[model samples]
Target: MGKGGEDYGKSEKVGFEFRDKIFPAWAKDVKECEENFQVSHEVGLSTSEVQKRLGIHGYNELEKHEGVSTLKLILDQFSDTLVRILLAAAIVSFVLAWLDGQEGGEMEITAFVEPLVIFLILIVNAIVGIWQESNAEKALEALKEIQSEHATVLRDGRKVRNLPAKELVPGDIVELRVGDKVPADMRVLSLVSSTLRVEQGSLTGESEAVSKTVRAVPEDTDIQGKKCMVFAGTTVVNGSCVCLVTQTGMKTEIGMVHSQIHEASQNEEDTPLKKKLNQFGELLTMIIGVVCALVWIINVKYFLTWEYVDGWPENFKFSFEKCTYYFEIAVALAVAAIPEGLPAVITTCLALGTRKMAQKNAIVRKLPSVETLGCTTVICSDKTGTLTTNQMAVSKLVAMGLRPGTLRSFNVEGTTYNPFDGKIEDWPVGQMDSNLQMIGKIAAVCNDAEVEKSENHYVASGMPTEAALKVLVEKMGFPGGVNSQSSSDHESILRIFPHPWISFYFSCIFFYKP
Candidate 1:
């Protein structure tokens, strides 16, 4: 839709024409933005070209809204009052066991054996449920992690491997491969007739892999020039490269706007679902508490002649030794009133929820996350193929230098090359190339991205913004030297981590002096 909801798709002058007409004043150069609010720029594509070439979108732009996380359901089921009471009963039973043991040696075990075994069984079941839930959380955290495995770059006149991608100052020739992740943004200088499917889900908010090509771009472009340039974090769907490292880490396109992620709500949203689930869980706990209280009260009467099985011996009952029966039945009542089986049931419910969610694509990490899902007033979720339609489409195309061509098709063709329209048949392919070739080569050669075809779609291993550059190159034709394509996990390395941030650091590349 246009600014006013008009279908600019039908208009002939909306793409390049509209962009050329509205070049904003502040978008002129690097100095325009605040010095502290650092901006990223690629040489081949201008700011306007970049902006016009790409659209501002958030990830998860395409997805069906599912109601709640499985964890939430689990938490809702976790509030069984019987479970709570049972836990207390278990503790009392353990104390009673110790009391018995103190009165006699191993023979005293009989005094506590009945309740002790009951509580232990109940607690064991609860533990198993909790263990299962914990396992679910662990399973969700296994997403692929990207790391800096020394980049292959041509420094004086030979190919050399270095530990630092940051040392690759602009103008350095870097070698790329199918399985390599883009360590930094670069301009492609050379390549085999390779193909790389770059995923720009981070930048344009489009998650699907975009085809790339080596073509020139507009002087005022904003997003296209960097399309071929691979950044850090994203995976390369395919291809190999020898690019000129243009930008690194924080200075790359994805890095600058990384902060632009919509700030999460300070307070969580109180959804009806959460409120109802919470209320239900709480009510269930209360109901169980009430039921347990009544059951214990009724069952107390059934314990007649306790001396037969326990308590004072039947034969010595009321013996005239003047020895008072030492039974503070009230405390016993309190401890016995707690249902020992509730906690186990509640925990089992939670574990089930956790398991269910894992199947639906929602990964719950923390123990509280199970309950938190039911009470998630605010969720700061990643906007990848999640909230949005993971299947990204070329909704609108704004050609910068091409001859007033209208790219109105909305089909999601996943090929790594630009589709030909009847208009393009009449128009020379030269138009697409002249405007995109250099931009493509620069972005591709300068990139630190690796594209690989996974089980299904193409994935990039570098920066998403750089993947955008590569995808754009292939999409606009000019496909000669640059390609975004590659292979997958042929080598598996195992490392033990003392902390999670270490893994984050490995995936999160940095730009600094080597």
Candidate 2:
């Protein structure tokens, strides 16, 4: 309970606006989050200050790659390796057939040597491919473990002592120190002259640690521009501070950077060469077929050497001519058009792409998603979690007016730390502006939330935000915001109002702002 005896004038607790920013109220087994998650609250900080303290988040527990990469999957579907061997064997068979077609001729050494050489080359290529795949597997096995084992945060409304790191979510506040890589992204809710310098070389290509500060920066500032904010995967080089956790894992700014790298690796160059290769095969087949038919037809119609009186050997020679040129042309066409080895090269390219993607923390499950990433035209983004900090802080407050003697002067305010940066000149004027007084009274008198007077300052219990609302009412000049429920000022719900119950199993106060 580090905050148990801290300031009561104002508090550091805040809220953010995010779609998936769970309140940790409705989540099942929320206590598990306390054991594993680490979101801390400092006594006094703005939401922007909280944002500066927290760091970017990503997969604390890396999801297992359920399937092989898309390239591996796609290449696995190809029959090119089989076809290469088949085509090579066919070439050898064609050469042997040509030699057999020769009359009274022995098998030439050229025919045997050529086919044998091609077979050995194909074998060597297959061996080289296997070696590359084995090397890639080894590299994959050595990759960094992305999932976390434990987290550190607060439990049962107390200071961040310690917990695990993996259970972090958007709302959890985590305390960090020097040399500790921030477990999650957070806003600096409380820092006591703490100079935290973190290395951003991996994310920003910068070599030095960016200085941490609590200040408003221009919106156009680059990722490297926000001097106060710390990101994930960045190591803290110096100092310590209490950070109010903002976003965790995959929802962090650095996580978005990781996603971009993943998307880039997913997009690949077009496969125009492959498509053209297929079309060329079809064209070559047509050409070969036409040429072979014409050669056969000409021999049958005009090249037949038949005569009435002829010797047996000469009669055989007079038989219709075999088209030697057509046979050679057909082999040449098959060799040129059907790049029987091309599929293997394309498969190699795909494997290389898969390896590149692994380097970027993207495990490609769907083969076509790679192509789709390259071809994608639009991306749908959620503003709550993706765009906005979802980190809520009381940046500005306007007082309608203040009433003096109407409020029962409370002494607990003296113990709380002063919050006004630019000190106000005066206290409440004696009953000024009736409407403002009514708003202040209604806000304080409403029941549900409470603040306790501990050793020195009033510490809020239940919702930090609700506690902050009561602080607001008090600041605007509503003393104690309660009549009292006990003597000795030892124990009583400070903001008790005997109004109709709004709802049961619900924790809230009606502001009646309208």
Candidate 3:
């Protein structure tokens, strides 16, 4: 919306669009990106300029549509074709009963029983639908609340810690460290360590962390191939990096995904079950129409009056009142053919399914969605963050002995990041094998990952492989259990080579005490 404004002509605009063309940040180097966004590595956007950009770019978050309204939910329950047909039949029957009673000059309360029962069934179905859907909406809203609330940004030559992430705008310099979530899409300016990797499993479905580079990439690179960029909603795993914010809010990659999901949801296709039900409803309506017409035509003979003179074609007279009387019977027959309880039965079954899924932490926004999922035969899904926990755990540990033929193998317990939960081979681990202890000590010393206890659980930061090693050392009860400050006792770094690409290994040479 801010495009074509006074800032449209400014060369320092942060968006990818420039008039009628697109200028990608990943295709430009640090100097060009700095000039284009008016950002710097040392002194970031000033407070006043940041405020002005915030007013233009809006918050650094995806747009969330309002939840389903109560009225809409209620109306949606009656949107089925069969339900609409039944509703019409009920109204007509009620009107006919009232007219009959008025013409007879008497109150006929019991004559309205059929229509009242149909209306009651419809109301019950609507209530069940609204209740289940509303609960699902609330559950989804709760899940959306889990997000990064603050960010660290460089402003006016000083580091501002704990700045609200939503206030972050384009052109701001963001400093990302281990375990910190990226606040917006940014172009990497510099990496503080030899390996700066971002955990993009949530964004790109990559199980392993992606190594980032400061070099510019091709403009047409796909999202997964853009090695020079980090997107919002991803976390820094291994090393620190200074990046320039290029896009925020709905302009970011995650924001775009969110928009696509919202758009797709609006035009969702009918599921197999829904389509079948609709077809059956149409067929049933047609059959009922033909049957009712046949009943009226066959019963028309009862409406004819007989004359004293008998002839081939002039012996009978048509009576309009008698003919209309038999029409009520046809209407009754049509109402009887309607399946008034089908909707209620279907809704109740779906609600039960919704309850079972909710117990497993799944929410179904619509009752029909339950059937839609049941209709799935094979699902192609990203396994990294969806099917797996995305955390590395040490399941087995083996160490070579002093002799070539001598070897000791041990099974490490626990599949989570918690170091103290499980022991080696279900043993106490208090008296670990000497070889295992030595290997654990080496793993604890040479690793760069950090594990800390947060509240009730342990949180790992850095490469998952290194984190797993750190957890193993701590699980073996190494001295000074692994933490962020764990380092070599008496060693000096001589050389280090972090090959995180093809080899997926980190080689380091250290001089350590015996």
Candidate 4:
């Protein structure tokens, strides 16, 4: 116990901010990061060290905001201004009916009908809103479960273990392979393959897989330019790498963006449709109140002024009973003017529209979003095959030898991944040298992909770019079968180095040990 022991003791103290005290791990080289964090890239952290780091870094997960309870969501539905006004009207109506009964007059059943209807509408609307919100939250939770749950990590010298991603701490050496989601932000330490590729679509929205490198990039490199780093949530699409965990949980770059989203949602204003509906409700309420007041005043004046002839005349005698009757009539007029059923109808319609949108593969998170979409005038969209075909084929190929210029070039004709349908013509067969043949062999053997017959055509199961290359090899008069000799030899691919950001070419080393 010397300097190392003192550092460990200080790490255990309260109010120690690890991030503020150390240089950003992403900006540092792999060796520098390992030294600063006191971790071994080969053996990772010891069991005791992992526990101590967990205590200091918290869990390796995003901050989960507690979901709104069902009861609370239901109560929130009634908090709308229009709903509150209806509730107040209902209460007034019930009190008036009770006063009538206490005065010894015959209690009409119709006197309670409006209040009962209002109450029913309020309850139904609240139930629908609560159900929709709860289902959406549950679906989101299910998706999170289906993603990455456990990570393969090195611990306690040479032992490898599959631990929950949430339990992963910084400085852990994690292994990534094709189809595996990166569990945390990591710096590429070393790789078994010459090139490891990851699909950063979740973070960068790019359709192509990005290549990763062990070399440290510039300290001021932008997120997309950091070729040495692999972020959490992106999937490893090709090859494999052993990376040192630099950041985990909310400290990662993806986590920072997630935190920004949460903050923006907290400060979200009302949607356009919601704002318009509220303004309409306020205006309608004022208009109804004014109309009701005018009617009541005119009725009182008419009743007190003249006498009635038969049933057509309007004149009547002034009395307390007449005044009470006129007041009751005014209250009834105000209640009738309000469209009590309007809220129920609107809610039901919006809910139906939401269900329809979901059926069409478009999910509407909120009811008002349905109306908002209807009012939208300008819609922006990505131009990637959403409106057209993204079918790709090799239009031309130029092969060159190591000695000088072009050895032989050919024009290829194809329209998709269907390998059997394409052809190459005008080839200088006399000049089909060993270098050109080697290029074709490299294109075929270095790839870890296969094409299979699906009904009437061929479909590939790997990267589209690699699949296109395989088609090229087939059109070059080589055996184009899925189990062709070249493809069979692909099993001996020793390493692949893909240049995604720089040259878009892959260099490979092959070994055939039979």
lDDT of 2 at 65: 37
Ten-residue region with minimum lDDT total, candidate 1: 1-10
Report, for every candidate in turn, its global Cα lDDT versus the true structure: 0.44, 0.46, 0.78, 0.71
lDDT of 1 at 17: 23
Tens digits of per-residue lDDT, candidate 3, 1-514, equal: 1121212213343345423344578888999988888777899999999888888778887677887789999898887879888898899888888877887899677999999999999999999989988887777555233346788899999999999888988889988887788888889999877778888877778888898999987765667777889887788877788999887877776665665556666787777777888888888889888988998999877898666645445567787667767777888888889988888888889999999988766878788889999878899888886788778888887678558888666788888788877887754456666676667667876666778898888888777888899888777775566432334556766755567665756766887665
- How large an RMSD does model 1 have? 18.1
Give the number of the best model, judged by TM-score: 3
TM-score: model 1 vs. ground truth:
0.41
Candidate 4: segments with Cα more than 4 A from true spot: 1-19, 98-110, 139-147, 297-324, 360-363, 379-514
Rank order (by lDDT, best first) = 3, 4, 2, 1
What's the true lDDT of residue 156 in model 1? 38
Candidate 4, poorest ten consecutive residues by summed lDDT: 1-10
- Better by TM-score, candidate 2 or 1: 2
For candidate 1, lDDT tens digit of each residue in 1-514? Answer: 0121121112332221222332221122323211212222222223343233234211111112233355664453335444455555556556656765665556465667656766676656645655655564345323213324467765335467763654444334566665566665544444443455565554455545555544433434455333444555454544555554444443444443332221121234544544554565557556655665665455453343334546544643332212111222433554554444444554566667777876776765433347667766787654666675343223233335445744322122343322221122222354545444454555455555445566655664544444544554455555353543211122122321112223322122222222
In candidate 3, position 498 carries an lDDT of 66
Clash tally, candidates in order = 103, 39, 0, 1
